[model samples]
Target: MNKCIFFFLSLYLLCFQSFAQTSSVKTVPNADLVYEKTKLGEQVNSPYYEGQPVVSADGKFLFVYRVGHPDNVGYKTYKKDEDIWVGERMADGSFSTMRNVGAPLNTATNNAVLGISGDGNTLFLYDQYNLSADYAVTNIAVSERTTDGWGKPQSIKIKGFRWVSEPAYMNMSVDKRILLISYANNRVTFGKQDLYVSFLEADGTFSEPLNLGKDINTAGIEASPFLAADNVTLYFSTDGRAGYGNLDVFVTKRLDDTWQKWSEPLNLGAKVNTPFWDCEFSMTAKGDVAYFTSGGQNYGENADVYQVKIKEVARPEPVAMIYGKVLNKNTNEPIATKISYTNIKTHQNAGLASSNPKDGTYKIYLPKDKAYSFFAEKDGFFAIKENIDLTGLKTYTEIERNIYLVPIETGVAIELSHLYFMQSQPTLLPSSEDELEQLFDILQKYPTMQIEIAGHTDGVGNKQKNQMLSVQRANAVKDYLVKKGITAERIKTVGYGGSRPIASNEKEETRKLNRRVEFKVLSK
Candidate 1:
């Protein structure tokens, strides 16, 4: 009985230890599984092909299509009665209750459902028409949701570039003002069926159209664009870009306002592509779910809709932290301080909890790819300024530094790689005086800046004697700065003894590093 109890206890302890080692992770849903159309409503007409379904903001209604051709341009034998369909998902999970919307919204034209905004206030539809060459010409139209019903459709126009063919298959920006349009068989030299964007002005007119440029548009055909709700990411289809086969859905993202620095286009991969054409891509508002048409085995008939999950490219988590303790130069103890960070790009401010009173350590979370202006201020201590430039950092980093507040001193200790001090000694010696002259030049430039002359000794000999020797060494430096024409009023002297060392006194090199004077900036 005793052996069994011990065995179970050991097993429980091992399990608990394993659980403690693993951190909880947030789960993200697959982007493609959000929407799929399986069957037609019983009340709806025969043999319905209900794909390109966009859900309303409340997730109740789905706006889709029933037929592909209305003008009978390509399908000459099929009926030319293309209609936009609407189905509301009842509370009990059945969509047999589908209804056709009223006039001025769905016409006899080839009106294909594009997308709906999250607020349910705007609906985008693509109207396909026949051109002079018997090819299809597609234009985009938007309808505003009025109190009673949708307003009359307004044709979208983009300036500059003329050949805007397929607007219905494009995605809109977050504000629903900017639209991404695709052109097919147009004489665009860069890529076939390239995508373009046009911004809607305040007067309901669109601005000049601009090509999606090199990162997104490839040499081959690229169409069927979808913008995530964030408005910075774009997902589209292209056969020219790197993919598993024929045409594949790809995604790119905008960094800041610059579209040129977009992420490389990612192929939706084998699950979303097939041997034949797999283009026309659409996604949910959150961007986790993507749906496209494929002539694969899962589809019962020709070119059925298939869904696949997509993940946004993972960005490196920012983990670089600057942690340091501010200490009083005289007492060698921590001090409470206030800190602020100025963003270098936007000149914005960020910080947390000021500086903790219990400990002088301030931990600032630094971004992986941006510079920051770090400022720390306390009532008596002079303000501290540090320009942290992280323009090209890739991985997580950590740094520890100790800030010494110079007592009102004429000379301050500045950390320099070449400066060296003898163990438990405060003498300037023969080697370091040349570097100290550079300090004299710095003090002359900042005339108003006061400083505290600090002296330190390695963890050796009597602590009290080391402290006294450090004071004498600091006085010696003050005399030098004053002789160099620095104002005597700006000078203060403080001796830290062996109590405060920049590095551990374990090695001879560290001991040499510890025994030194730092010309700390007092005020400027």
Candidate 2:
């Protein structure tokens, strides 16, 4: 009777344990689940250690850090140098033959690819070399994608970096405004390594780095931070937090506009984490697939890049992606041009990107829910302006806007899209500064260029009153330019009133278009 009782108790305990395990498995968030794991084939992974995979925003290119190659520039050294290799996605979904990113970026010393910009026009590299037998140094450098491959690299120096901490890895926001860096050995660190962020100030300098705080950083090391294209989700690796094994990848999200606050870190779960080291995770802009480095048995003894279909992953802020080419209006040939965008309501610089001279193609990321004024400018071309309003966006969107810049010649009129004023009043709004500055730049670029600033009012008031208001608005623009140091003689102001309407006055939208400001190049 005693033996039977003991056996029955053991059976009950086993059943209970099984049920608990099943329930726990069911409780995992769908986003934390992965549908499949695929080991990238020889085109990407070799016997050599390949890690730190980053895919292009368009998902057409893959960049990875590779070690132990016979063709390595550091082959003679006792410690082989690591370099970046890139592969193009093939038609069948496999990658093409991997090619070394090559020199200027890779030298006889250790060099690693840190991150690529969302537009795929910039490459960030970590360069470390022995300055002398007694000491070594590591620094981050940037290489711009030019018509003829990557241009020469330039070292990036952050002002006011604490001397004690060493930077591990870095990633930038989709808009290229905020930079996230992992630093080790700083006195303010919450763990062996912690994530810090720096913002691109209006003056074009990086702000002092600030810690991400205790919610994200742990008492153990946290490294390999990757900020998603949405700009809010961050994926990083930590051995400090409770996890399945060494340096498992985890994700957290920015809770608010402040970079310091974050949601609690969530482990990627058993499907993604393993007993061995798993780190250096990155995902596509859409967040459907995740690429990470692992040393699990399935990937062999050495670290290799593996990808999985993540059931759920944190998404970036809702954004509208703009991509297209800038071409010569007449020749239809691609032209390299500078693109600038301004937030119409806040009068803030949204961001800037340049079209690739080689292909004339360019891409930019814009935060949604704001009206924007986009301008494309080049030295000899009359600048063009485009207005976009994304105030009601509910999901990510892509816009194709190919710009054609006309050569600066007499009679070329470029409308000022950003100029605004108080309702029915002649006073210019502060948001007009961006367009005013742009006009200032054009005038400065062509010292002798003469332009006529014209203002028109919608057909909503008395003709005489409308004419007076239009003239005042035009003079207001002229005053701004003169205040900025342009000679008053170079600018002439005029008012068309409601006589010269560009669109019909039947609808408010058309009337808004009719009420406009424009500059016509008179002489250059």
Poorest stretch of ten by lDDT in candidate 1: 22-31
Write one digit per residue (lDDT tens) for candidate 1, span 7-50.
99999997765455322211123313432323233533334454
Q: When superposed on Cα atoms, how far off is each prediction in RMSD?
A: 20.9, 5.3
Q: What is the lDDT of residue 355 in candidate 1?
A: 39
Candidate 2 residue lDDT tens string, 1-524: 99999999999998877456434432125644454678889999987888788887767889987777877777668355678789998899888989998877777776777777767887767645323344333345678888778877776655565333333677765566677788774557888788888877766666778889988988887888988876778889887766666677787788887777897787777777777878878777766677888875422237788887754433555677888888877778998767877787776777767778688898877766788877678888765667789998767788999877777778877778668899898888886777688789889999999999998998987999999999999999999889989999999999999998888999997889988888899998
| Cα misplacement distance, residue 274 of candidate 1 (Å) | 2.5
The candidate 2 region of ten consecutive residues with least summed lDDT is 129-138
Top candidate (lDDT)? 2
Model 2 regions more than 4 Å off: 1-28, 31-35, 129-138, 162-167, 201-205, 296-301, 311-314, 329-332, 380-382, 404-406, 421-425, 444-449, 457-469, 483-487, 498-514
In model 2, residue pairs whose N, Cα or C atoms come closer than 3 Å (at least 3 residues apart or on different chains), thus clashing, are: 31-312, 230-316, 230-317
